[model samples]
Target: MSAINFTDVVFQTPRRVCHSIWDGLPGAITQTRAMRRLGRYIYRRFTRHTVRTQSHYTQFMRNPPLLDVLARLLSEYQIGSTVKLASIGCSTGAELYSALYVLRRARPDLKILATGVDISSEVIKAAERGIYCPGQSAATNGLYLEGRPELFWEDAKALRDLFEVQHGGTLRVQDRLRKDTNWLTADATEGGLADTLGPQNIVLANNVMGPMDDSLAEVCLRNVMNLVEPGGYLVVDGIDLDLKTRVLATSDFKPVLLGQEELWSADGSKDGWPWVRWGREPLDRTEPTWELRYSIIFQHARV
Candidate 1:
């Protein structure tokens, strides 16, 4: 049989077809075929983009509102004096870089070590290179308007100068870069997290919970909580869980509803395109945090 070009096949149809025919043997065969076709479609999409762009657009979002919320949450807790920050699902290093910039501006005197972990070696390599898409820089610059007026190019140069790409594969904040900040690639639930971060002041898990299954998300959260100092902060955005049940179980956690100024750019620049302040009402304390709102911030209570 001649192979069909998967790219020619559309995305929505297969997902629909798979769901529509998920019962009988013939239906199962159809579903299996659809899944293979879907995989090829995704592969084609991945191959068409540069690794850096792929990392930026696919791996994660450099959520401005979430970053601002983090900075505010840290200040509320005075995190700079106590907690170093660790980021889970830190694809291509934007989250770490964002945290570093916020911390530097918010608390220059304090030492901050940022560790960025991801499951993908490809993402880690792209992050180590420290390159960013032009649009990404523009977006970051727009987000950081309150602290630094410079363009994203200047910000990128500042970041490159401040952070050191260690030969050991860890990205450390060295010398002029505040000396205390750092980043690494590892599983958050695995053995090395403790060694890499010591104890964390703030752990930022942004928009990562939804991709993993429910059980994995909970385990990941527990791992992050384990790293926090008692009274240390845990800031989370884009939680993936049944908020009603999970929030009840995790009573110590507080949900933060971001105000417009805290999220959208008042300057009305399109540079921050998709990040424009979308009002996200807090979940009923049970659904996934991100499902109802575009973004949210959470604080882990002192144990």
Candidate 2:
């Protein structure tokens, strides 16, 4: 055998030890209030200097409760025959398509105009094609199906309505879902984005801000908020809660409490806990201002 690689072994040992400690902890202990507080403390200490990677991961119906609440809000509050929606940083069009499905299913009579925007030309092309192949990496095919595999199962007839199963197990977005939908390559952080897209009735900027630097994320959040029409809604998540709270406090937006908890616990936003830079903290209701801090959807005050 070659000489013992002590340097590599030493580095690997710490990871193994950390994993062992994590795995050894019981759910009872790990899920306790004290443990959660400790976890948050550790996360804050380490992630203060961390820089997050640009993620293109996405899935269909990643947050059903959010979409349901959005549809309900539109049906109740919006007084128009035409509804416009824009999904900024819309990775591979999965979330956008899911939103369209929910809105159309809820109110088929209304004319819906939807746009999916992403900075990557590659993802924009994939969104336009609307094709997802099985067993491919998200970077390769622009789909992350592992977390929500049941959505594609043959037995999941209701969820299956969203896609047309093609030859060799590929899924093509159905015509109904594709109709009146446009995909554009655009930088959401750039100025004049609001002018370019016009005011949208519902602007979704979810699962995209967490990886950005805090100051940049704040700027992007404000820019994205400007895309919303005066009375329209902005559905955002996956950012620093403190930053969000501060920004919303200064803005004319009010948090919508409907389905707030459900959206917080949704798949993409829920997992990894305090370890990953993009991971969300546990929803702590004991905090006095939990509702405003935890809510993922907010409606702008109508001028």
Candidate 3:
């Protein structure tokens, strides 16, 4: 080959490869993107395989802002009335139970029909069981509260009492909560999700489809939104920003504000005294220790 031809061939080969990679950047489906997506899928698949020892991800007081919004909603919806609540992807029932316990504490007379759903039968059964290790409670409730407890201690205690802590600290949720809350297994991605369960006054789908494809997430969210009763609330924190933006851009839905720091203050100020963080990681103890509090408490505009 001639000298110039040889040089051209070397440079041309790389340019084609570079062009191919850059091309994938813009389109929905690219070879590079597909491979990376497949890698992630495989990793998750394997991680799920070791479920026997894996700690199902969870957080304490996942979002206090939702509680604040709920409190406000109650006052406006009705001074004392029956409200329906549904927690999608309720995973082991922590979030579902938390909502029920907190709301019931606020309005002792208000009747709440709560539903908890997930895709995994084992997890649903575990949720139905309503049991958690002691460490689980301390991480969510203990560290987040840090030094303050009097304000929330009563409600926390009421919930803790509902558990029958047996030998080895396997806490079982008592009949009081289990009787009122229904647990089931259902896929959110399908159209049947709405028909399977009727409308709800408050629908929580947080941390459910975060790991799924954005397109799939959007579809599931839309289906879930349809199930919300008119003027009802929907919470989906785990969703992607793109999906949220597109979803909110529509006239049908409006984004709900999160109190954040406002939730911890006496008057609920975003720039206030009480923060949802701790100065130091405290040692383990019998009581729960709350160091870092929950992240954004997402909400949805009533339609």
Candidate 4:
């Protein structure tokens, strides 16, 4: 019994097991047609554990409200030269690219340095390539596995100036836009942000830790925080309210509300375009906090 392989019973389909046996059996054993039929059975069991997330496009939300806040900050501070920005969990580089586009549009004279980091290598590569197509390249890496196809079309339209669709149905980002974008692979749960990516003026740690347990999320949140420079901006839009409250209880940086303290945002720029914001002000880190107040104006807080 110890010699028997149980992969067939546990997960692999019957056809997969049969093919394995057929190849392993001695050449003297005749391969029967019945064996082939049995090998073709196509059912397999799935693991109960949740699968890892795939990288996805930002649904062409190239105009995130976060950009508006950052712009206001930059202008207020009179930032003349280079501005460093990092997108934590930058799935497929959409968010990072969007930031770059905004900076270039708002402050063309300033040089924009952007880095994108994600846990999934597949998604990182996709982000690096900076290419997409509704029919072919959109789902190339299995991202947006459950989202509808029409959404890609809508996103493409929203970001038309940034990318061009080829005759063969592949979308390519403009070379000018792709020049300054850098891609990195790292996990926030592990504290390598310092070595992998040095401190940044602004860090976007969005959409990763919110779903996890508080203890685990805290560890990951610290990892993300490590990437932010002193007095710098860190966007924690993905964390749950409870986790945010607990984690910020000890930190010196204030909590900035993005999109009225909601998971998703809308700035009313377009019918479907989503927007983001950053609001933060604490009476005292050691003292209690106050109620949620939405504000569009972001004062220049240069780190």
Candidate 5:
């Protein structure tokens, strides 16, 4: 296998498209060129589309047991009162909603403060809509459905007729958001996250550490640990478990693996968009590469 070369495309395609689209209809080709360059830089220089595409693709992917993995992780955490779970860089709210679904099923009584953080206004708005593309229901596996879609669909019609407007279809879920769950928009750096979440019972930094600055990662973990009360747990994705080991060693925590077997079939890791990661590396498969191939659950040791 060889590395896929995106460099040529990165350098040439954007200009070609820029010339093709904004060549005539522009007051400022200079500004359009700059914007197009920035767009190309984002899309080509990194795995920008991977997360967006994965949110939809997971419905079709057979290998990744997302709900099961989450259930295992939550069960391992054994969350209690004042439980807080943050999914850093949670784009489009799939992973956070997925966790919410599992938590609602496994421990409905637990007071959950689920916060989803993202930088994109468009994606956040999509999340607020909460009406997944009919396929997201697969990720839920019908775990915590309060009523049939028919019932909700009827309510949507009634609301439309009574109010003479369309407002409360899926967006109603955002309104019905538990007092504990919040959607925040902020940059992960600049101390925004440090202020929002504190010593959480379970903090999910899954797939976030790998893409962020090391200092940001440290601050993020430190914030979670600082907020975490004694006996509280911090859950991180195993993809960066090795790096986390180095970082955690300096802090006051120990590694506890939430087994990968139940979460992943023995043959190989299942495929899906890593709700918060770049793309999976080609050489990622090997013995117990749950974090690389699937999601891994880890608990924070004391302090």
Candidate 6:
């Protein structure tokens, strides 16, 4: 065999042992506040640098609670018949379409104008096509290798309603769902994005900012905020908690406390904890500012 890697040899056994212990702990013990806090500390100590990849990874109906909250917010807050929404970093448009589906189902009377923006032209093009094939490679479709059509949804009826199954199990987004939706390729971190996209009643920058360094993520967060109209809502998740809290502190955007815990511990996010850089830490209610730290949705106060 070729030369062995000393780093793996030195660390692998200890890591495995730690994982075994963690897994062996009963839920009752592991769920305790003290234990959770300790786990968070360990995670922070060992967290790796987030690698920014062009991998367009997403899932349909990823967070039902979040989508339901968005539906409620739009229904209660928006006035006119037409509602404008945007999804920055809309990879393959799964989240964007999911939002559209929920909103349409929730408020059938309102006409929705949606825009999906991504920095990758390839993903943008794929999103516009709205066709996903099982086992398709990133080279052909710009989707992550693990991105399968079946992962789009668990409910068969819902999948049938949203997509038209093509030859060989490929799924194409339905025409009604695709209507009035624009796909544009642009960097969310770049300035003047607000001017180009105009103000939106709801802006989503979810599951996309975690890979960037803090400086770039902060810049992107601020730029993304500009796209939201005053009194509108911003749905953000999967960014550094400290960065999010720090940036929003200076702005008029106040956290929406409803469903804060549900959103924070969302199934899509909670499972990755401590192991992945983008993973979310356990929610700690003991923290005085827990509400601000856990809330993923924010509303811009009207000037």
How many clashing pairs per prediction, in order? 9, 0, 9, 5, 6, 0
Residue 269's lDDT within candidate 2 is 46
Off by over 4 Å in 2: 1-33, 77-80, 137-158
Estimate the TM-score of every prediction: 0.53, 0.84, 0.61, 0.65, 0.52, 0.87
Model 1, 229-293: lDDT tens digits are 65566665444324323642545655455653355332223221111111122222232444223
- Per-residue lDDT over 88-180 for candidate 6, one digit per residue giving the tens place of the 0 to 100 score: 988778889999999888888788999999887888887888887644522244534323442533454566778898887778889999999
Cα displacement (angstroms), candidate 2, residue 244, comes to: 1.8
Which digits, one per residue and each the tens of the lDDT, describe model 5 over residues 103-192?
666676667778876655555554555544331232232112212121133334433311123344232333333346777766554464
* Candidate 3 residue-pair clash tally: 9
Residue range 29-86, candidate 4, lDDT tens digits: 4234433222222111122112433334344453466676676556633557777788
**Which has the higher lDDT value, candidate number 1 or candidate number 4?**
4
Instruction: Name the Cα RMSD for model 1.
Output: 12.8
Quick one: best TM-score, which candidate?
6
RMSD of 6: 5.2
Candidates, ranked, lDDT: 6, 2, 4, 3, 1, 5
Question: In terms of lDDT, which candidate is stronger, 1 or 5?
Answer: 1
As for candidate 3, its clashing pairs are: 60-140, 142-288, 142-289, 142-290, 143-289, 143-290, 143-291, 144-290, 144-291
lDDT of each: 0.49, 0.78, 0.56, 0.56, 0.47, 0.78
- Per residue, candidate 3 scores C-alpha lDDT tens digits across 91-169 of 6777777677677767767888899887766667767767666444322322112122111333445456556767875
**Candidate 5: 10-residue stretch with minimal lDDT:** 142-151
Model 4 TM-score?
Answer: 0.65
Cα lDDT, model 6, residue 266:
71
Evaluated at residue 174, the lDDT of candidate 2 is: 92
Q: Which candidate do you rate higher for lDDT, 2 or 3?
A: 2
Give the number of the best model, judged by lDDT: 6
- For candidate 5, give the lDDT: 0.47
Sorted on TM-score, best first, the list reads 6, 2, 4, 3, 1, 5
Instruction: Please give the range of 10 consecutive residues that has the lowest summed lDDT in model 2.
Output: 142-151
- TM-score, candidate 3, is 0.61
lDDT over C-alpha atoms for residue 108 of model 4: 79
